[model samples]
Target: MRGVVLHAPGDVRVDHREDPTIIEPTDALLHVSATCVCGSDLWPYRGIETVDGPSPMGHEYVGVVEAVGDEVTTISPGQFVVGSFFASDNCCANCRAGYQSACRHRVPMGSLGTQAEWVRVPLADGTLVPTPRVPPDDLVPSLLAASDVLGTGWFGALAAHAGPGRTVVVVGDGAVGLLAVLAARQLGAERIVAMSRHEPRQRLATEFGATDIVTERGDEGVARIRELTDGLGAHSVVEAVGTQESMMQAIRSTRPGGHVGYVGVAHGVTLPGEELFYSHVHLHGGPAPVRRFLPQLIDLILDRVIDPGRVFDLTLPLDEAAEGYRAMDERRAIKALLVP
Candidate 1:
């Protein structure tokens, strides 16, 4: 099998690798049908996140089950499935409380490398969600999106408490951020503000239900959000970028009593205790519990009520995985889909 390996910053490659096989009775093997580069993948590619060695890359995936361990009964071979980056038992206390990402037996899937012909999924019954049937070729992308970005975006909206009669602001314009805008709209936010300077992203934001676009950065960006909210700031703010500046912008753009839901992978961020103490804004975010929302999101996509797949502006064969990384790092593509 061939898979993506990050040798160093700006040095991603597609190379031959040993094929995956079931190692645990609770595991399942999947023949990956579609996978994609994630915004978070750039962290290692750009050296923002250090890599000690040539490590396997990619997490978001949608595939057909090729085999399953004896313990895996809920899912079977030949079923199409979508799952989160973190594999969970789904029966843990945290999972029961709707936080599968933090399940007691959680296993990070990036190390398993889904951007390949096949990969092993641990705790298969709890981690993988089978689609009603094999989705059509056209619906594959949307189902792939639900594997990560769409579910993460939905978690962002839920964390921010987006709902009818509330003004919501999204602080990033990446795929997840754009999907967050969509999630906010579906959650019934009366107004959705998307902060982005790129014309392409701004256009997509509007198409995804953004009522306003703010191009400013830092303090100016917060001011624009407040101005549009009649000087009270937005009722809820979704921080999709995990940088210090984006986090501050999200915090500052929400009203004192409002909520700030941050989903960006924080790199070198530090929130001053005093500032947060007086800000009075509620903060909630981490690895999104994507499994918690997979069932509902899958239903929405299958019903054609939403089109989150539109976020993928570029597509490439799995062998051209390096180009996929470059396109995203250069901002030439919002998201890149990889077919194996």
Candidate 2:
């Protein structure tokens, strides 16, 4: 098998790697049909996140099950499936409480790498969700999106309490952020504001249901949200960039009783305890428990209710995974889909 390996920052390569096999009775092996380079992958690629020697890359994946261990029941060989970054035992306490990302037996799939021809998924019954049948070619990307970004965006909207009559603001214009707009719309938010300077992203945001676009950042970004909301700020704000500036802007852009759902992987972010205590804003977010919403998100995609796959502006063959990373890092692509 071949997969992506990050030898160091700025040095990602597609190299021959050992094929994955079932090591646990609950595990399953999958023939990866589609995979992607996520915004989070940029962290280590840019050196902001440390790269300690060689490391496997990629997490979002949609595939066909080739084999399953004895313990795997719900998912079977030859079924098309979607799985997120975390392999969790969905029967755990946290999973039962709708936080499968924090399941007691969760495993981060990135360490195993999905940017390969084959992938080994653990806790198969709980981690993999099968589609009703093998979807057509056009629906593959959308199903792939459901593996991560779409699910994360759905979690973001739900956490922010987006609903009928609510005014929602989304910070960041990446795939997740743009899809947050889509998610907010699906959740019935009355108004959706997308903060983005990039024209392509702005256009996609609008197409995804954004009622307005704010291009400013930092304090100016917060001011724009206020101006649009009649100085009261939005009823809910979704932060998709993991930066101190983006985080603060999100908090300041929400009204006193509004909610902020931050899904960005925070990098060196810190908050002033006193300011937070006085803000009267509610904050809730972390690694999105994508598995929790995979089933519903899959149905939405299959029903043609949402076209989240439109976020993938670039597609490349599996061997060109490095170029996919480069395009995403250079902002030349909204999201890159790699075909294995």
Candidate 3:
């Protein structure tokens, strides 16, 4: 089988690798149909995060179950499924409390990168949610989005308490941030303010439900948000980019009593205690417990309540994943979907 491997920084290649098999009773093997590059993947690709020899790439995936271990029962071979970026036992205390991302038994899916002809899924019953049916070809990208970006965006909105009568300020214009705008609208937000500098991304933000676009950065961006909100700041804010500056912007753009739902993967950054103390804003974020919302998100997709797949403006064969990385890194594409 062939899988995407990162030999070193800026060097990604399609290489022959041993196929995966069901190694645990709760495991299942998937014939990957679709996958996509994530913003976090760029951390290693850009040399911000170090990588050792040939590390497998990719995490988000939607595919058909080819096989399942003896213990896996809810899902059977031939069923189409969508899973979160991480594997978790849904029965754990944290999972039962709607925090499956922190399940006692959790596995980072990146360790088993889904960008391949086949991939192994652990905790199949808990992680893989079978779709109602095999969707049409075009729906694959939308379903795949549910595994990560869309799910993360939804989590961001939820964390920030975005809903009817609230104003949502979204920081970052990447796929996840754009999806955050979509999520905020679906959650009943009255107005959405998106901060972006790129014309293409700005257009997409409006199409996704943003009521206003602010093409400023740092303090200037926060000022624009405050001005729109009558100096009180937005009622809620979503931090989809995990950099120090973006996080600060999200925090500063939110009202004192409001919340900030952050979904960006943090990298070598720390928060200032005094600043947070003075802000009086609620902060909550980590990996999204997407499994908790999978059932509802799937229903929305099946009913066409939202179209999350628009984030993938570019598509490529699995063998050409390197181009996907380059396009995203160069800001030429919002996201690149891979068809295996």
TM-score for model 2? 0.99
lDDT (CA) for every model shown?
A: 0.94, 0.94, 0.93
| Residue-wise C-alpha lDDT for candidate 1, range 168-218, written one tens digit per residue | 999999999999999999999999999999999999999999999999999
List where candidate 1 sits over 4 angstroms from the true fold.
Answer: none
For residues 1-340, write the lDDT of model 2, one tens digit per residue.
Answer: 9999999898999999999999999999999999999999999999999978999899999999999999888999999999989999999899999999999999999999999999999999999999989999999999998888988888888889999999999998999999999999999999999999999999999999999988899999998889988999899999999999999999999999899999989999999889888888999999999999998888998999999999999999999999999999999999999998
RMSD of each: 0.6, 0.6, 0.8
Model 3 score (lDDT): 0.93
Model 3 per-residue lDDT tens digits across residues 78-188? 999999988998999999999999989999999998888999999999999999789888778888999999999999999999999999999999999999999999999
On the 0 to 100 scale, the lDDT of residue 155 in model 1 is 90
| lDDT over C-alpha atoms for residue 302 of model 2 | 92
Clashes of 3: 0
> How far does residue 79 in candidate 1 sit from its true spot (Å)?
0.3
Pairs of colliding residues, candidate 3: none
List the candidates' TM-scores in order.
Answer: 0.99, 0.99, 0.99
